[model samples]
Structure formats: C-alpha cells, structure tokens
Target: MVGKTHFIGLMSGTSLDGVDAALVSFDTAGPLTGELVHTAYLPYPEPLREQLLAIHLPGHDELHRAALLANELSRLYSRAISELLARSAMSAETIEAIGCHGQTVRHRPDAGYTIQLANPSLLAELTGISVIADFRSRDIAAGGQGAPLVPAFHAAALRHPTQHRVIVNIGGISNLTDLPPSGKIIGFDCGPGNLLMDAWCQHHTGQLIDQAGAWGAAGTQLPDLFNQLVAHAFFSAPPPKSAGREEFNLGWLDSHLTGTESAQDVQATLRGLTTYGITHAIETHCPNAHEVYICGGGARNTALMDSLRAALPGKLLASTEMLGVDPDWLEAHAFAWLARQTRLGLPGNLTEVTGARHPCVLGAIYPA
Candidate 1:
C-alpha cells in the first residue's frame, strides 16, 4: 500500500507559546505507524497568545469573540502548515491530511467536558486538506479524562519489553506514562512543568526559558517551599486524572510567594517543584522503573534533568534522542499518528490507561 506522503500535525499546548508544526511521513497510512520527517514551531504572535490565555476562562461576551479567534488560530495553523510544506519543498497535494490537537481552553473531563479552541471546518477550508480536530471530547464523553492523549503514541514510539520504561512529558503540566512490560499503559498529569517556571523566568529575568537552569541555579531551593508546592493532591491522585494551567497557574504561585521571595529563589523553587513533582509521581506509580524516556520542552533543561536524575537515584534518565527520536517532536508526531487513527477509524485512547468507559474512535475531522 502506498503510504501517506505527508500529514501536518498541529499542537498549541497550555504554555500558550506557539503552534508546533510537524510534517510527518507515514508508511502505515493507518493510525499508528507514522514517522516524522520535518518539524518546527511557529510561535504565536503576542496578540494571539494574550487572546488565548484570556479566553480559556472567558466572560460570556468573550464566547462570540472566542469563535472568531478560533478561526484566527486556524489561519495560523494553516500558514504554519503552508510554511512547513514550503520549507520541505512539499506541496499541499502531497499531504494526505492534517491532525490538529487544537488549543485547549478548558478541560474538565471529570465533569464530562474538555473544550479545545479550534475551527476545524475553517481550518480544512483554509488548508485544503482533511483536518482532524477536537481529539479529546469523545474520550471525555466516555467517562475518561480526555487528556494527555499522547501516551498511546508513547506506547508505540517507546515501550521496551526487557525494561520497565516511563515516558515523562514536561509540558505546561507534567505527565508520566508507565509502559511496564507486565502491565497496561498508565498516565496522568503529575504537576507543574515549564508553565510556571517559564512565567517566573519571564517575570524576573528577560528569558523565555531558563537556559541551562542558569537563573534557577542562582538561589537556594527552599526545601519547605518545595514541600508546599508538591503537596497538592494532584500528585497523589490516581490515573485518568488530567490538569493544566487552571490548577497550577500564576494564582497558585502567588499564594506561595512571599514579598521577600527572591526572583532567583523562586526560579530555583519552581524548577524543584517540577523535578520533585515528576519524581514523586514516578516513585508513587513506578518505583521499579529501570529506565525513563524524557520528552517535551522540559527535557531540554539541564538543571531539571539533573534534578530528575538525583531524585530518582537508581534509574537511568535520558531523552527520547537517546532512542533516536527528538524529544521536541514527540507530541507533534503523536497528533500526526492520531490524525492517521481518525482517518482509519481507530481508537486513539487506551481505555485501561485513561480510564475511559470504553474505547472510542477519537477526533472530528474536517475535509479540505
């Protein structure tokens, strides 16, 4: 069978940073066997970022405007895909379809709702390819937390039988997937990732991310501060639970920060919070995990990685690059694979892992 020459995967994470575009090539044409060929992040214009962050918990009047911005986001996705193709010298005709994760505005699966801001129909109209958007709602409807959907992709992209492996994605909020040899896939939001840390860095210094943990390395990590942040019930909660900025946003930090809190001290403490939260979740769930594959933006942080290693003394911690896959591209690639699943009518959510009532075909597609 001729495989898809291309499929553009679009993702706008909780950090509200930008759209990550991955132009993937797949041999399966089926849902799960896609391979990434080219990937890039098209940053949101500052205006769009502000619009997104504000509308997540929007006012009633903002709902109508939110709809308009959804198209705005779609246009961005369209242009990013167009750019992705142009750089790769591939044309829209060559792309089989596009899988968009959509901008997550609000996700409360426990209450049977997860809204991702997107205009799939417009996206398809604009992009001239089938667009698969809104990938989480169906799972939420099935009595499961419709989030961290990338774990199914992790199971495919990683998962070693000889070793008990854990794939940890430190995005806006940290989430971990335990792909044990003997058990089924299990994953959930561990806690804060780069969201708070990035905000703090932007607040104190002028950096978007803590480069080599430089700023965080400045001050003392308050053991007491670390304990307060990590004690949130989210860490101890069982699988199928998901979270985002709603839980760990600036408000949470403000509550913890004292007037005397040094900028560097806060930075160090936030990094510790991430490292400790992820490490604690790993210990709570997969203490015996021999090796863990790190992905997402946080994996690039040397200090965070070092802290993770120290926290998990006996385990070997490494990035997906160690396994021949770029960490940054993993989640984008997952949506690409998911787009394949939507087109093939496959279940992208694993019921056992996500606690969905039943496996259901995920996502709604819009044809160009």
Candidate 2:
C-alpha cells in the first residue's frame, strides 16, 4: 500500500449506451491522484440496450429478468476490462481491483434503496481480479440520495485552491459539484441530460444519438415547451437530490407535448431544457464560481455546450480535459478511485454533498 497501485473502473451510465472502462494508477502515501494508464469502451448491442431500458420500469418477471441481465452485464463488463488490460499490454493480476458502477435500472433514494445491477462475483471470476461494486447503497442507508457520488471524486481531482470551480457532469442525467475555495462541497442532480434527447432522437430519426446534436441544432427551441420541461419539480428542489429515468423519461416528455409540435422543435426544446438546467444550477448555487468544467457524454453535444456558454456569460466554460482528465472517461476513472478508497478503508462519500449522516466507505468487495 505504500507505492502506486493500479485499478480498473467501469461505468454504464443512464444513457444506457455501453460500458466505459478506465485503468488508472494511484499513489497510496499522498493526496489522491489518479493517473490514467488505459481506457476502453464497449457499446451494448441493440437487443441488450433494449432489455436494459425495459428493466428500468415495472414489468413482468422482472426479478428473473434482472438476474439474467446482471450476469450478462458482468460478462460485458469483464470484456471491457479485458480490452483495457489487453490494449495496455497488462494482465488481470496487475490490477488491484475493478470498480464497476453497474447498470442502474432503478435509483429511488427517497425510498431508501438504489439498485445497480451487477454480478461482482461473476465479474471477479471472469476477470481474475478483485471487484468492487454497489458503491451507493451505504450512503442511501445513511439517509442520502445515493446518486451523484462522483462529487467526492470531483473534489479530490478537480478542486482549485483559490478559485471557486464547478464541475458539471452531463450524462443521461446532469449533476454538478461546487468546489469552493473554502467551504463544504455541494453537489446534486441538476436534471435530465442526454436521456430524453437521445430517446426522442431515436424515436423520430432512427439514430441512437443526435450526433453532435446536429438535428437539434438545426431546429428552433419552443418557448412554451422549454418552460414546461424546465418547470419539473426536480429542477426547483433543493440540493442533496438526485434524479434518473424514473423522474425524466419519454413518458414524462410525452405528457408535456401536445402531439402537434414539430419533431425537430421538440428535439431543440429538449436540448434547451438540458442547457437551462445546468446553467440555472450554477447561477443559483455557484454564482461566484470562477470556472466551469463539463464532463460526461453530454459534453460531446456541441449544441448543448454552445447553449451553456451562451447562457452563462463571463464564466469560463470548458471540458474537464482542461484539468487533465478526459471528459468522456472521468466517471469511469472515479469508480477506480472509489475502489481504492474502499480497499484503503477510507471514507468515499462527502457528507455535506450527499446529505448522509456522515461520510462512509462505499462499495462491496468480491475477492478473486
């Protein structure tokens, strides 16, 4: 535990796109530092993606279905890890552990439970490495919204000494971490990110993603639709809150639409809603924030990023890469760091951020 140790992190976010794997090294004796050694991504097949999307809602024989999917997901995760190690010319024995943030089919922290479908024992067996999974339940048990656990990692990796920096992760759901020069860190889910937009795009255009947000960028935002979309109670709720497809999904969007609006305009409005949510969160909570760094899949949406820049004038907005971490892989890297925390018996949740009773070590272990 004295020198550098390597770990692999895997994340399949709310977007339900695929698994992202990151191999990282950290120094055990100093302040937490993650040095990225390798990364890999494996997109879920169309059928697998459909099954995962269906599992998010109440359904028939879901328990059996979920169990089967968990084992399948473990194999997929193992493949991602194998790709990472192979590309790096390393072996499973070289890694200390694999931190896997499994597919979240349900995340209702208010109900005192969150389910992230992952078969860590299978993953450990498949990869021949120790596995750490289910990193959120402890925080929820401590009376917190277990979603958005990445803020602790954000603070450790991106906090600025003299500047108030905000890190906004725009995944299927958007969340921000307020890293003030001197104060308790603040973080929570802002609102929908790419989930609705992607859903809408796929439904109308047959494309899985908006592709740089070109389709939306070519359309015009509808004022009334945008207002209604942004008026969701989740956006106005106080911090220490988290959200998922349960809160904002195609069903939610369909209810807001009149069924007469132009499809492209609706797409444009969804993009606007995402930009407004993130900007409003920063303006209301981190008014004096010096710089804003964005990560996650949504950061790849050019139109969304442009809208954010336009909405928040005078604030320097850029990708997390400005801070030396790739935006697309930051979350995956965080899980690796979280696994290290668990291994070292260190607290990983930030109490102020998650509204937990106190900081706690997160995740369960499956030894190889």
Candidate 3:
C-alpha cells in the first residue's frame, strides 16, 4: 500500500434506491489496480426518494425544491462518508478526495444540458474532505454524451489482455463497455435496466423491486408487448447515447401498455426488454466479445440473469466479481478512481468511450 492513494466514491443511480459509498485505494504505479477496502449502501428515505423522483417533471417552485433536495443529498452523502470512514477505521485526512456522482434529475444531452443535483461545496463543508464532483458537464461541454463514464475505469481495472470482453452495468439504465483484445474501447447506454420494471413492480406488488425477478418469473412473456416496448427509438439510435427518467419512466411504459394484460406479465415483458436491449447492444457492437460481466443492482436479478445467459449463448456470462470487483460497488469504485485521476490532473473520460473530442480531465474540485 506504499504507492497507493485512498479515495472514496459516492454514487446514487437512476434507481433512486440509495447512495453507494466505496472506500478504495489505487496503486500509484502501474496497471491502475485498486482494492475495494470498504463499501456501504445507504438507502434514501421514502419521502426523499419520492421527492427526488417527483422533480423530473414540472413542479411548483422547482428551483427552491431542487436546492433543498441538493442540500438533503449532501447531508446524506456526508453521513455515508462518515460511516465509510468509521467502517474502514480511517479518517478524512487520510483520504485524497471524495468522488461524488450526484443524483441526476435531468439528462437531455441533445438539448445541450444535464443536471446532477448535489452541492459539492456543502458536501466539502460538511465532511471536511476535498470533493471532486460534476464529472459529466465537462464531457457534455466537449460535445460528448457525458454518460457511461465507467467504461474508462472498466478498461483500466477489468480489461483482459487476450480475451475480448464486455462489462454491462445494469443500473436504472443499462450501459455496456466493450473491450476488444486490440482496438479502441467502445461504450454507450443501451436503454432501461430496472427503472421500468422497478416502477411496475412497485405499482403492483408494493415492493421496491421484483426481488431477484421472482415476480417476473411467475408471469408469461407477451411477445407483442415485448416488441412494442423494444420499439422505443432510443434502442435503434447509434452509440454516444444516454437516457434517464425522462425517457424510460412509468409514463413511457404506460404509453405502451394496453391495460388488458396482467401486471406480472408486464413485469416479465419489462425484464425481457432489459435483457434484449443489453444483449442486442453487445452483439451488434461487440460480436467477438466472449466474456461478459454484469454489475449494479440488475446483476442480482436472477430472472434477468437467466434471460441474459439465454440471449448470449456460447459466451461466459457472470458478475464482475469474477474479475475482483464487487458488482454492486464497481461504479462507486470507478468514481473513486476518477477522483484519483482528477486529483493527479489526469484524464477521466475516454474520448473513444464518450465520443469526446479528446481525453480530458473531468470534474470540479471543492476544497475542504
């Protein structure tokens, strides 16, 4: 650990489930190796989650509400950090910086703006630690999609030397990182991961999610419904694309539903849509990839995993744990690595992966 530096990463994905905090140390020497020393997940309060989800559309006094929400998120993040340090038996002074990927409320890359609601100044003030945040605006400024940023970290930590591989992260949205044996790394958002399914499941079962997809497994897949769900134009669009609650939320799903099918059947169709979008993206963009590793909340969904395995025959399909990174914490750890990059004045966004004009050092620094 002599040549390594410690950093913490905080991530709250589109699922709005909670914040994931990872305490990681990366080698300052070569190969970009890192160890996941400690990890913690802090679920957002139900009211906070509802408020966070509600702001995606027109709301009363939106600016004041957003500011208040940002402060609340920073407080939650500070709590997670305090817990992460206590759990790791470390102090804030020992950490080089905290990489915080704020909760995204809107992402309209086409309209030339995206918003991740977090007050880094307040976070730094509250935690007494340097913070690196706003990791996306720079990419979007450079005409990139400002998403799927983890692929750069994937290439560093999970890339195989002789085998073609893909890292699929099934957060609220599914994104793929293609690592060929000898070529530029390619990555893009494939579409919905658990957003639609989670929404539907909550509406019907009163559960946060399908719980490893058992609810979905009990229902039959409706081909017509599945086709309709997949017909969304985002799936057909080219790479360098990203989506959010703006596109794949319940309203979008409702537009495709006929109200005649069972709720479980709709869940099954949503599961199929997630699996198909992921495999289709991989096959179309990374046909030679033989090993696929999954990460994020979706990795635990047994029903979704079964569908992915069936869809990608003759290939190895497993979680990123096979490569030493916990599937649940990989993205959080990636942000930790990115914080290292930013602190060292190195590039974080891969031009190839994000379609940026060049590799640029990302994020803003907020001094403690």
> Model 2 over residues 27-144: C-alpha lDDT tens digits?
7665575788899999999999999999998999999999999999999998888888889999888899999999999998888999999999999999999999999999999998
Candidate 1 lDDT by residue in tens digits, 1-368: 26555778888888788999998887754545577788777888888887787886647788787898898999999888888887899878888789899888888876788888889998888878888888899988888889779988888878887889999998888888999987777888888899999988977776677887877887878777778887788877777778987788877888876778788888888998888888888888888899988988988899889989989888999998999888888888889888888877889998876789998899987777
Q: What TM-score does each of the candidates earn?
A: 0.96, 0.98, 0.98
In angstroms, give how far residue 111 of model 2 lies from its true place.
0.8
Off by over 4 Å in 2: 28-31
For residues 1-368, write the lDDT of model 3, one tens digit per residue: 35868999999999999999999887767457478899988999999999999999988999999999999999999999999999989989998899999999999888877899999999999999999999998998898889979999988888878999999999999999999888889999999999999989989988998999999999999999888888889998888888888888888888877899998888898999999899989888899899999999999999999999999999999998888778999999999999988988899998887888988899999999
Q: lDDT value for candidate 1?
A: 0.84
The lDDT per prediction is 0.84, 0.92, 0.91
Give model 3's TM-score versus the native structure: 0.98
Which portions of model 3 miss their true places by more than 4 Å?
29-31
Measured on C-alpha atoms, candidate 2 has an lDDT of: 0.92
The TM-score-based order of candidates, best leading, equals: 2, 3, 1
Give the count of colliding residue pairs in each prediction: 0, 0, 0
